[model samples]
Every structure is written in C-alpha cells, then in structure tokens.
Target: MSGATILMLVVGAIAIAAAARRYNLPSPLVLVVAGLALSFVPQIPNIELNPDLVLFGVLPPLLFNASLDSSYLNLRANVRAVALLSVGLVLFTTVVVGAVAFWVMGPSLGWPLALVLGAVVSPPDAVATTAIARNLKLPRKSLTILGGESLLNDATALTAYRVALLAAVGSGVSVVHGFALFGMAVGVGVAVGLILGAAAAWLLCKLSDSLVEVAIFLILPFGAYALAEHFEGSGVLAVVTAGILIGRKMPKMHYATRLQGGSVTATIDFVLETLVFGLIGLQLPSIIASVHDRSAAQVTLLVIAVTLTVLIARIVWMFPATYGPRKFSKRIRERDPAPSKAVIGVLAWAGMRGVVTLAAAYALPLTMDNGQELKGRDLVLLCAFVVVIATLLLQGLTLPWLIRRINLPVDEDQADALAEAQAAQQAAQAAVDRLEEIAEAELPTGSTIVDDLRTSAESRANAAWERLGPQDESRLETPSELYRRLRRDMLHQERTVYIQERDSGRIDDEVLRRVQRELDLEEAMLDR
Candidate 1:
C-alpha cells in the first residue's frame, strides 16, 4: 500500500475507536465493521494480510505489550487454570475441530490441511481478549486467567500449525514426531526468552539514559522472537517471556524510563489494535474473491460448520476444565473453590479468533512439497475468516451484556484500598525511623527540616487512610485533601512562571523542562 493509504487507515481506525467510545460499543467491533464496509468500495485497493509481516513484524510487539501489563505473580497464582486453557484446551480444540472439518469437507480437504484450519482458529486471540476483557468489570482472577491464557495459548496453537503445515507439505510428520517437535519448541523457546530477558534486565539497570533504556525494551521483544524462531522454536512464547520479565523490573528502573516506556507502549498499543482489527475486516472481500471454483452452497455449509465447531469447542472444553479439578481433588476444593456457573458461561463465550487465525490462514504456501497445488487452501482461508468475524460479532458484541446481566463478582476494590493504606502507613513509619537515624549520625537535619519531613510523611499516610472512610460529598475536606488542592495550584503557578521565563528568553527550553518536571513530580505525590 502507498503512504497515503496507510495514513488513511490509521486515521480511520482512530475515528472508529472514538465513535465506538461515544456510542458505548466495543472498538474491535466498530473497526472490523468499518474495514469490511470500506473493503467493498470501488476506490479501495485489495489489501491483504501478509502472513510474514504479521507473524514477524506485527505480532511480537502486540504480545510483548500484553505481557508487560500482565502480573507475573498473578499468572503464577492462576497457572493451573491458564495451563488448562492455553495448552490443554488449545490442542484439544484443534483435534476436535480438525476431525469435524475433515469429516465434513471429506478427503478433498485432507487431514493435514483440515488440522491446519483447526490450528489456525484454535486459540482465543491475545489482542482481542485483552482489549475487550480489561474494559469489563470481571473478577480479578477471571481477568488474570483470561490474560494469561491469551498470552500463552498462541504458542500451543502456532506449534500445532507448524506441525500441521509440515504434514501438509508431505514432510512425513507423525503423532509421535509432532509431540517431539512441540517439546523442542517449548524447551528452546523458554531458554532463548530467559537468556534474552536476563540480558535486557541487566542492560536496563546499567544504563541510566531513559531514551536508551526505553529503546532497549522496544527492541528486545522482536529480537527475542526472531532469535527463537531462527532456532525452530515458538516466537510467541519467547516474546511473551521477555516482556513479562522486563515488566516486573520496570518499577525498579529509573522513574523517567518508566514514565517514557509506559507512554510509548500505550501509544503503540492503541494504534496497532485499531489497524489490526480493521485489517481483519478488510479481508472479507479478498476472501470472497478467492472462491472462484467452489459452489456458493458448499462454501456456505463449510463456513457455518467450521465456525460452529470453533464456538462449541470452547464451551465444551471450558466447563469440564473448570470444575473437574475441584470435584476430584479435596485439596483443590479447599484451595480454589469453583466459581459460579455465570463466570464459566462468560469464559466460554469469550472465545473470539483473531491475529493468529488471520495470519495462519494466509501463511499457507501455494503448493505442497511434491509441487501440486495445496488443495482446500481457499476453503480453509474462507472458513477461518468466517470464524473470526462470527466470533467477534457474536461474542464481542454481547460480552458486556452477558457480564452485566450475570452480575459477576467484581474485584475487591475495598480490600485493595485497605492494602494500599497499610503499605503507606508502614512506609511512613520506616521513613520516620530513617530520618531519626540520619539526624543522630550528624547529617544536615535541622530541627525545622526534620519536623517538616515527618509531617509530610504523616500527611501522605492520612490521605490513603481517608479513602477507606465515608465518601459522601457533604463531608468536610480533610487537611490532606486540602493540602493536595493547594499544592496543585502552586504547581500550576510554578509551571506558568517557567514557561513565561522561557518565552521572555531568560531561560532555555531545557531549563523550563527541568523545572517543570520537578514541579510535576511534586504534584504527582500529592495525589498519591
């Protein structure tokens, strides 16, 4: 595509997202619908999703950003559930869906291509799930499981896709051989990811430059992915691993680096999400255009069948995967009681296909190893596209409604508030002790300075505790809240003066920025 077209696409997706927010609809739905409609316009080009660009160029960052936001501790806590969804359920869905597709499409489609289609649509998309789920007020554990599953499931799905592709190209892969390939991918991918993650963590710590540190994080995901894939391992897993590791260390990095990295990551995430979903929509026209020889009825039958298989397979897999452990193991019951059926219902319905499905469908080679055209490649692509849209429309649109109507338990905001208050109190006490120790050691701790410092720490702790109190607007403004309000006004004045000085040529832009940043940090602490 031309530069003009790319610019238009970005602008259009942003517009769609804005409109989606205005109307309280999901951005993914709006983007896909807009792209599908635009695809039919006579002036538009036949923009296809390039498999190599998406898998190599686009996918790594998307997965990396999601992993960065994910809590390593939370993922570890829910590892069992995530594993059931990501690894076990994905493989099961691939076989069940593959069996159905082959049985329906018959020998013409063949087992290998049939399984390839299955693998293509097997996992719920990380981008889609994260995009939609985070907005809704699901339980914390539910969010963790969904985020963790989406992060790792691509590894299982892609590995299956790779194995199936080998079979399709007549590489003579058997059940035993496929399992061996999977084990190798997991082992190698994890190793590469850890080695790269450790190197990145070290570099980030050693480097003090915020720009350079942020740049390292930005490049690390792509490099890890490429390196892992070069060794015939899963790139998705490698990128995710590196991102999670780096994210955990972000808090320890320089504040400037944290702020810069966060801002850059959020911007990239918004732009990429909008373009990708819209691109998926633009695909419908090309998918339809490719089915020249297949009869309309046959195409219709296969699309519905495959789409149903994808939808139903998730529901079938999730309920058993959820409750089976609790029923069989007494320890499991005590440790993790079963969630309400309503939560499980929502989980089952959250199975939307996206990036991997779209890229994997297009990634198929034109011909097998023996040089014959890869039969059913067109149908596979068609069915995969149908499944993607069908799930997005059906599940994405209704998810909010289902969640609201089900009255799912929300995260413990009150408990979280209490924890914050406790932590602040303890930290304040620690600070006070350190100050006394410094004063006793004959540091520049004047009586007035020490008193002011102690008072500031106490005020911060009081602000946190106030949140857990009554929140009536009629309540009088506490000293802490009043102090914050007064401090914000002071910060504004300080920034105004700095800008005025810069405008009058009394100070350079650098000086203005330095002063403004100091004021900004001080102002930020008030809110905390």
Candidate 2:
C-alpha cells in the first residue's frame, strides 16, 4: 500500500510487541510473526524499496547513532578481544561458511559465487544481538566483546563482500591487492571519522541553541559516510569511527547539551529502528517468491545447510580463537579478559542477521559483467531470508532462557551507582555555573527571590559534593533517589500546567519548546 499503510503496520507491530513483553514473550518473535501474517493479505501492496535508500540513507545514520550511544572508552579497553572477534573471527567464519556452502550447495552455484554468498552473510548485525544481549545478565567483558564484535565486524564483512563480488564480476583481484584494499579502507575510514567527529563536536560546543546542536548530530553520520565512500573507503567503518569519537567525548558535554542531545538522538534511533524492522518485514513476500520454484526437499536442505553453517562457524571460531592467544603467555591472559562460557554460548547464539545482510543481498545486480542474468540470485535471497527468520525468531526468542539456564547474571548495581554519582556531579556543577551566571548578571538589589534561589541551589550543591566524598571510594551515597522522585512530581505538575497554558494560548512557542525539553529529559532519566 502507501507509506501510511507501512506506518500503520509498524504501529500495530509495536503494540503487539508491548503486549508480548507484558506476557514475558519475545517481542521480536511476535513482530516477525505478525509481519509474516500481514504480508500474506492480498489488500496490502508489496513494497518496492530502493536498495540505495535502505543502505546509504538508513544504515549510515543507524550505525552512527549506535556508535554514539556506545561507550568508546570501554570498547577500547577491551580492544583485543573485540578485534579478535570482529576481524579474525569474522574471517574464520566466512572461510568455514564459504567452504561448506561450496561443498554442500555447489550444484546450485559455482564455487566463486557460493564463496561470495558466504562472505555476504558472515557479519552479525550489532543492533539485533545487542537487543537480546542487553536483556541478559552477562559479564561486562563478554558484553563488550559481543557489542564490539557486532559493531566492527560489519566493516570487515563488507570489505570481503566487495572483493568477492568484484572477483565474481570478472574484475581482476589479487590476494595482496585485496588485503591492501581492506587495510586501506579501514585506515582511511577511521581517519576520516575521527576528523569529522572532532569537528562536529567542536561546532556543537560553540552553538548555544539546542536544536542546532541536534541538527549537527543528525548530519555528521551521513556526511561522514558519503565523504568516505566517495573517497573509496568503507562508509560503515567511517560512520562507526565518527560515532566512537563522539561517544567518548559525550561525558565531557555541558548538562544542557548532553540532555537535549541525548533526547534528540534517542528519538531518532527509536524511529529509525521501527522503520528498519518494518521494512525488513515488508521484504518477506519477495523472498517467498524467489523460493517458490524450489521443491520442498531442496528448500529444506538449503535452509538446513545455511543454518548449520552459521551455527557451527561461530562455535568453531569462538573457543580456540579466544583461548589460543592466552596460551602464548600468562601476561596475555592478565592483559586480556576472557568471556564466561555461558556468555560465549549466548553470543554464539545471538548471531541474528537483519537489515544489513538483506540490503546487501538484495542489492546484487541483475546481471554479471558478462551480461548474463544472475544465476542462483533467487536462491541466495531465499537462504538469506531463512537465516534471518531462523536467527531472529529461534535464537532471539531462546536467548534469555539460555542466559538464565546458564545462570549468567548481570550486575546493574554498578551501572546504577555510576549513573547516580555522575548525575549528582553534573547537577552540582550546573548549579555552580548558574550561580556564576546570576552573579555576572547583577540581579536587582531588592530581588529577594533570586538571592533565595541562589542560596538554595548552592546549598544543594554543597550537600551533593559532601555525599560524593573521595573519588577513590568504590561506592558513594547519593540523594539521587529522593531527587528523582521529587523531580518526577515536579514534572507531572509542570506538564499539567503546560497543558492548561497551551489550551488557553497563554504560552508562546518558545515557552512550549523550553517546557518540552524539560519534560523529555525528566522522562528519559526516569526510564531506567
């Protein structure tokens, strides 16, 4: 149907997901099933999406936003494991998959093309795995490894895919050249991202208006990606690099900047995720059409082979690759943290494919360089669909159960403590800044209210600072819980007043904007 129909489907799916969550079911699985059922309805028109729009338009910003939200400093602290998994592990899986697919399904395609297909599906989607991983109580190191691997492996897989595709298209490709290109792509992308990220942050700092700061955040990802891709570097890598740079600097941001910026970014990410999932669901019909000609037995075999290939490849790579470097020296073991077996198992199972894989596969040209209609293109699409469905539904659904069965408990107490301490520090700092501003402005001598406000704010600041104590303390007490409760009540009252004022036309647009930002910040802080 129209774009409105697509919007409705997404809304309906979100409602179902909420219901499913309340019932302790996997919301993603519910969404997938609902999407499938909706797709079969004759009245719902098939979606014809531009691959460029999905990849360039949708993927870059999503990648950037995810990067921005992640803690780059923490990610860097565990860089070794992340690198091993993202680059080394991805290559290992691709080789295993390529070899197996060639051996088992070569009758469907030639070796080169089958290898290309294997490379295509190798990278795990960070977005999907992180969702499930976040729900589980895994070790911090393990979470880092999983999240880091998901974020970086896309660049690696994409590089390999490009080489493989070019070779398949009769472009001459040397092993040395391919390796050089891969290295160059990553190097260039990272360099570009860092430069642009720093520049964007500098601009945001100078720009006082919250909306302008938000707009800068929005533009950086696309701008970085386009510029990198134009220069023959990896856009995915560029987006991620920019994100990491920005994220590392986020804590240093001013309170107003952090609040408004985070609010805007979260809104964008939520909307983007909804659109991405809905678009993914909308592709099912075309996938079905591709596999329509295959016999049940053949379809079943292809599905099983691809499924097992993905499953086994991860297991094979994770165990030895994780432990191998440790054997060289105890120093390495000391330097590098290891993932718990249960966490490893959960990560292995969390390899759900999503928008990136689908976009890449569907983006395949209709013909090869030889002007021949692409053979087995439909089969590749079918297998990719099967993998996406199986992983998103089966593994995604069972992941929480596996984590619990293995007794992997997450320690969010640490997170809460850190958040509280940070909040108190920020609030105190904001108060100090406000007091300085009031002093500089030289308020009227008779204004007792301003003096009273200043004294109260300064008192609160001093109280917060005393409670925080020494920086070395493992735990610091905070008035944050009480503060949060009071703030929530304050927001509720303000919201009620704002609604009344708006209805009575007593507040202007500027007033509404200011109040809206306050409400948005209060809601976000309360969310978890």
Candidate 3:
C-alpha cells in the first residue's frame, strides 16, 4: 500500500470509530460499512498490508484487554464448563466442518486443504463475544464460560491451523510431535506471561506516576506476544495469561495515580478499547482487496456455505454439550439444578463470530503447498467476512430481545443498587467510628453527649440502608431520597456549567469535552 492510501485509511477509520461509539453500534460493523463505502470510490489505491500484522498486532492488545477485564473468580469457578466449550467445542466444530467440506468440496480442494478452511472458522471472536456479553448480563457462570472460552479458543484453533497447514506442506505431522508442541506452546506462554506480569505489576506498584503506569501497561501485551512468538510459543495465549494474572494482582496495587484526574487503569482501558476498535475497522480495505474478481455465483455460494456451517455447527454442538454437562453435574452433586432448555437455547444463539475468524481467513497464505496459487483464498476471506457480519449483526441485535422473551431471571440493577447502599452504610459507619475518636479527644467530657450523637449518625445511615431492604418504611422516613435529590441537583448544576463553557469562547472544544466528561462522571457517582 502507498503511504497516501495508508494515511487515508487511517483517517477514515478514526472518523468511523468515533461515529460508532456515538451511535452505540458495534465498531467493527461501522468499520466494515465504512470500508465497503470507501472501496467503491474511484482511485482509492488498493491497500495491501501484511495479514500477520492485523492478526497479531491488531488482535493481541484487544484480546489482552478483554481478558484483563474479565472476572477471574467467575472464570475459576466455571473452569470445567469453559474448558468444555472452548477446547472441546472448537475441536468438535473443526471435525464436523472438515468432514462436511471434504465430502462436499473435496473435488475442488483437497481433503487437507478443506480441513484448513474448517480450522480457520472454528473459534469465535473474543471482541464480538465480550461486546455482546457486556450488554446481556447473563448469569455469572454463563458469562464467565463465554468470556474465558473466547480468550483461550483462539490459541487452540490457531495452533491447530498451523499444524494442519504443516501437514499439508508435507512436514509429516506426528501425533506425538503435535502433542509435544501444544504442551510447549502452553507452558512457555504461561511462564513468560507470569514473569512479565510480575515485572509489570512490580513496576506499577512502585511507580506513583499515572502516565508512566499506563504506558507500561500498554507495552506489556505486545511484549508478551513478541516474547512468546520468539520462543516458539502461542503469543496469543501468553498475552491473555499475562492479562488475567495482572488483573487479578492489580486490586492490591495502588492504582491511585491521577491520569487526567482518574484512575490510571481505567484510563488505560478506555484508550485501549477505543484504539483497538478503530484498528479493527481500519482493516477493512485490505480484507476487501483479498477478493477482487469472483463471479456472483461463486461469491454467493461461498458466503452461503460459510454462514451455514458456522451457524449450524454451534447449535448442533452446544445443545448437546450444555445439556450433557448439566445432567452430569446433577448426577454427581445430587442437588445441582440443570439449566432450563430455554436458557441453553439462548446461549446457543448468542455465539457471534467476529475479528478472530476474519483475521485468520485474511492470514491465509497466498500460495499453496504445490506452489500453485491458492484458488479459493479470496473466497475464504469473503466467506469469513460474511460469517462475521451475519453473526454479529443478526445475533447481537436480537439477543436482548431473546433474553427478555425467555423470561430468564435477572435482577435488572436492583441488586447492584442494594449492594451500593450496603457498602455506603459500612463506609459511613467507619467514618462515624473515626469521628468518635476525634470527639472523645475534643469533647467537653460529657459521655451521653458523644453517645447520643454517634447513635443518631448511625441511625441515619442505617435508615438509608433499611429503605434498600424489603422493609415497608415510608420514602419520607429514608434520608436516601433527600441525598438522591441533592445529588441530582448538584449534577444538573455541573452539566449547566459544562454547557455554558462550551457555548462561550472561554474553552476550546477539546477542553470543554474533558470538563463535560468530568461532569458526567460526577453525575454517575451520585447513585453510589
């Protein structure tokens, strides 16, 4: 790609990324739409960047960020289900797809080559899965399984793809050798990740500077990926492992350093998420260039085949797997209740394919083992793109509606509100305890005076919490309503000031944006 073409693509990608966030749409969808529009324009100069760069470079940071934000405790508790879905389901899909493709398309492509296509589409995208799950608020077990499985499934499928490719290239694959490589890949990746995570954690703990800490956090994902690849391990797995480890270790680390007057880790996550989505969208031009000249019939067939295989494979495998486990667990534990069949159906439909599939398809080799140019590489890329679009748009948009239809139980923010009230009561009690210490030292030596004052303060805080519970206390009796009203008024005042500053020529647009963001954040904390 020319420098000018690259520059234009980057600029276009930024605009699309900002628009996607503003409109509350999936950023990748925005990127694809934008890319499709740009492609039809005359003289755009087709962009050609390395597929490896898009997969490893654009992907690891995104995956690491997803893993870091995931709940470690939830993942640990649901390890069995996650493993069954991630490893077992990925392998099963590959087998089913390989068999079907080989049986149906073997005349056009050899058996081994067909298998490679299957491997490419086996793992769902981490980015798409997490983005959808963020809105669903499924059970902790289900969410953890989905999130954890997405993180690890890519490494497994990619490793399998590499092995299958090597076999096709006459490298003479052995089961023993394959197992050995898999072990080494996981082991070296875990070791490197832990070492890097420890070092990063130590540095962040020691440093009081927010910008420096955020910078260090940014470097760690790429560093882990590069180091693992250098050692012949799965770089993707290493980045994920390091993220999980570091995230678990971070709560104890004082992330108190102010970055634009906010927690450093939170700032880092925001910057990384925005940039990653932007980059994912930016990859559109190159992906389109992979498919330049295909007949309409050929294109339609490829898209239909890929979409059918991906959608069917998930439903066929997941229904059995989800139910089998629930039954087995019930048998083993005696009191474990099975997930309702309706809930399982919702989980099955929730499997949205995304960036990882597109990345893998784009990463396909230009030439095959016999040195003849790969006939269907473009078709594969196009098919993968179709799968991503179909799953993300169709499933993502419909999932919330499906959940409501199923009538699966969920708290709908009431639980969170109650927890926040409980926590506030505890904090207020501690504050009262500290005040008592001060009062004892400074008071005029009247015991009843101090006791009465402390009791009254405790009663007010407890009353707020009591209103949150199942009690029938009148709303007027709860001081929380007053606090809530006061907070709302304060937030309104801040919002008005922000608008005034933006309207006046006193502050630049960017400064006004920053100030407005602060106001929004303060407004958000009013609930807590």
Candidate 4:
C-alpha cells in the first residue's frame, strides 16, 4: 500500500472509532463494518494483511498493554479459572472443532488440515474480549478471568496450531512430542519474561526523565517478544509476563512517569485495535475471491458449521470448568466459591475472536513439503475469517444485551470507594510520620514547611474519612471542602490571568501555556 493510502485508512479508522464511541457501540464492530464497505471501493488499494506484522509487530504491544492494565492481585485470586479457560478450554476446543471439521470435510480436507483450522479459530481474541468486558462493566471476577485468559491463551492456541501445521506439512508430529514442545515453550517463555521484566525494571529505575522512561516501556514489549521468539519460546506469554512484572513495579516510579506511560499505552492500544479490526474487514474481498473451487453452498455450510462448533465448544467446556472442581474438593469450595450461573452464561457467550485468529490463518505456508499446494489452505483461511466475523458480530453485539438481561450483580462501587479511601488515609498517615521524623532529626526548631506538610496530610486523611462517614451537621461545610473550593477558585483566577495576558500580547503563547499548566496541575491536586 502507498503511504497516502495507509494514512487515509488510519484517518478513516479513527473517524469510525470515534463514531462508535459516540453511539456507545463496540469500536471493533464498527471498524470491521467500515472496512468491509471500503473494500469494494475501486480507488482503494488492495492492502495485503501481513501475518508477520500482525503477530510480531501488533500482538506484543496489545498483550503487554492489557497485562499491564490488569490487576495482578485479582489475577492471582482467579488463577484456577484463568488456567481452565486459557489452557484447558483452548486445547479442548481445538480437538472438538478439529474433529467436527474433519468429520464434515473428510476425504478432501483430511484430519491434519481440519486440526489446523480448529487451532486457528480456537482461542478468543484478547483485545476484543478485554474491550467488550470493560465497556459493558461485567462482574469483576468475570472480567479478571477473561482478561487473564486473553493474555495467555494465544500461546496455547498458537502452539497447537504449530504442532498441527507440522503434521499438515507431512512432518509426522506425535501427540507426545507436541505436548513436550508445548511444555518447553511455556517454561522457557516464562523464564525469559521474568529475566527481561527484571532487567527492564532496573533500567527504568536508573532513568529519571519521564519521557525517557516512557520510551523504554514502549520498547520493552517488543524486546521481550523478540528475545523469547529467538529462543523458540512463546512470545505472547513472554510479553504478558513482562507487562505484569513491570506493571507491579510502576508504583515505585515517579508519578509523572506513571501518568505519561498510561497515556502512551492507551493511545497505542486504541490505534492498533482500530487498524486490526479494520484490516479484518478489508480482507473480505480477497477471501471471497479465493474460494473459487468450492461451491457457494459448500462454503456456506462449512462456515456455519465451523462457526457453530467454536461457539458450542466453549459453552460445553465452561460448565465443567466452572463447577466441576467445587463439586469434588472441599478446599476448593471453601477457598474459591463458584460464580453464579448467570456469570457463567455471560462468560460462555463472550468468546468472540478477532485479529489473532486471522493472523494465524494467514500465516499458514502456501505450499507443503512436497511443493504442491497445501490442501484446504483457502478453506481454513475462509473458515477462520468466518468464525471471527460470526463471533465478533453475533456475540459481541449481543453480549451487552445478555449481561443486562441476566442482571448479574453490579460491582460493589461503595465498598471499592471505601477501600480506596482507607488506603489513602494510611498513606497520608505515613507521610505525616515521615515529616515528623525529618523535623526532629534535621532542625532544632521545627520549620514552617513541616507544619504545612502535617496540615496537608491531615486534610487529605480527613477527606478520605469523609467519603466513608456521615456528614458533619455542626458545620455548614467541612474545613477540607472549604479549602478545596478556595484553592480551585485561586487556580481558576490564575488561569484567567494567563489567558488574558496571552490574548493581550503581553505574554508569548509558550509562556501562557507554561503558566496555565501549573494552574491545571494545582486544580488536579485539589480535585483529587
């Protein structure tokens, strides 16, 4: 594609995403629809989907950012569910879908080709799952499990796909050998991720400039992914582990670095997600054109069968995965209560596939070992694309409605607020203690700065308590509230003066911006 074409595609995608958000629609769905429409335009270039670019270039950052934003604590608590879905369900779906595909398209497609198609469509897209769950505000545990599964499941599906591909290419891979390879890939991936994560954390600590720190983070995911893949490890798991490790260490970094990193990752995630979904849509023309040998009825039947198998396989596995352990183990019941049926229903319905499926399908080698065309390559690609579109459009669109219909218990917003308030109070108290120690050790007489520090800490602690406690009736307004109002008013006045100076040509635009930034920072502090 030309540079101008790429630029135009990006601009169009951004506009579609913005419209999706404005109408409270899923951006992935809208982007895909828009791309499908654009695919028919005569002036538009036939942009080829590079599997390597999507996998190596795109997958790492998306995985990293999702892992970074995920709650490590929640993930730990839900490890059992995550493992069941990410590993057990992925493998199970591969077998079920593959078996069915082989049964339906046997003699011509063969078992190996069937398995390859199965693996391609087995795992749900991490990006799509996370985006939908967050937007719809599903149960916390559901979101955590989905997020955790999405982070790691790609490795499982891709490994299975690789093993199946070897067999399809007539390499004669055994089941035992495949399992051994899977284990090695996982063990090595985790080890590499830990090492790289620690090294990145150390480097980030040594750097002080916020911009430089953010820049290092932008490179960390790709570095981890490339290093792992070089050693034949699972790049997906490597990126995910590195992200989680670094995310846990973010608290130790400067607040400016944290703020800047968040903004950068959010922007990267938004742009990549838009492009990916749009690219999926844009492949429609090519995919349709490639199915020249198969009759339209055969194609339609294969697509429908494959799509249904993927969806049904997830549902069939989830029930046992959800309740089977609790039924047998007393300890499991006591420690980890099973989620309600409604939650499980929502989980089952949320298996929408996205870019990863298409990337894997496209990554299939065009020719087998004998140099003849790989059997069913087009069929597999078409099947994978159909599965993606089916789930994403069918399940993604209906998921929000399902959640609402189920009326699953809402998240505990009040309890969460209380917890945050309590944590803030503790932090404030620690600061006050530190200030007292400094005053006692450094100066014979306490400085005014010490008094101001104590006052500020106390005010913050009191405000946190106010969030939890009843209003004080004796006073018209709390002292902290009054102080915040006065500070905000003062900052507003400063901003007005800066604007006036800039408008009157008394100050340069740059100077006005600098002054305005300081006021904005102050206002943010007051609001917090």
Top candidate on TM-score is: 1
Cα RMSD, model 3? 5.1
TM-score of 3: 0.80
Query: Which ranges of candidate 3 are over 4 A from the true structure?
Result: 1-11, 17-30, 255-302, 329-336, 368-376, 434-528
Candidate 4 per-residue lDDT, tens place, 351-454, comes to 99999999999999999998989978999989988899889999989999998898989757768768878898899989988888888999568588888888
| Candidate that beats the other on lDDT, 2 or 3, i.e. the better one | 2
Report each candidate's C-alpha RMSD, comma-separated, in the order given.
Answer: 2.0, 4.8, 5.1, 2.4
Worst 10 residues of 2 by lDDT: 463-472
lDDT of 4: 0.88
Clashing pairs in 4: none
Give one digit per residue, the lDDT tens place, for model 1 in 217-311. Answer: 78988999999999999889999998899888878789889888888988888888988898999998789988988888867888888898888
If scored against the real structure, what TM-score would every candidate get?
0.95, 0.84, 0.80, 0.94
Give the per-residue lDDT of model 3 (tens digit) for 1-528.
566755665666667667887988766556655655655667655554455755666677777777777788878767777787778878787767777666655556565666667778888778777756776757766677788988998888887787776665556778788778878888888888889988887877787777777677778889999999899888888899889987776676654432332344444444444443344434456656666765676567656776787778888888777667666675634544566777777778877876677667767777766787776666666666677777877887788788888878765457766776677688778878887798878876767777887776776566556655546545453465566688789778877877787788776889877877777666665554
lDDT score of residue 88 within candidate 2: 87
**Backbone clash total, candidate 4:** 0
The whole-model lDDT of each prediction reads 0.89, 0.75, 0.71, 0.88
In angstroms, the error of model 1 at 489 is 3.4
**Candidate that would win on lDDT:** 1
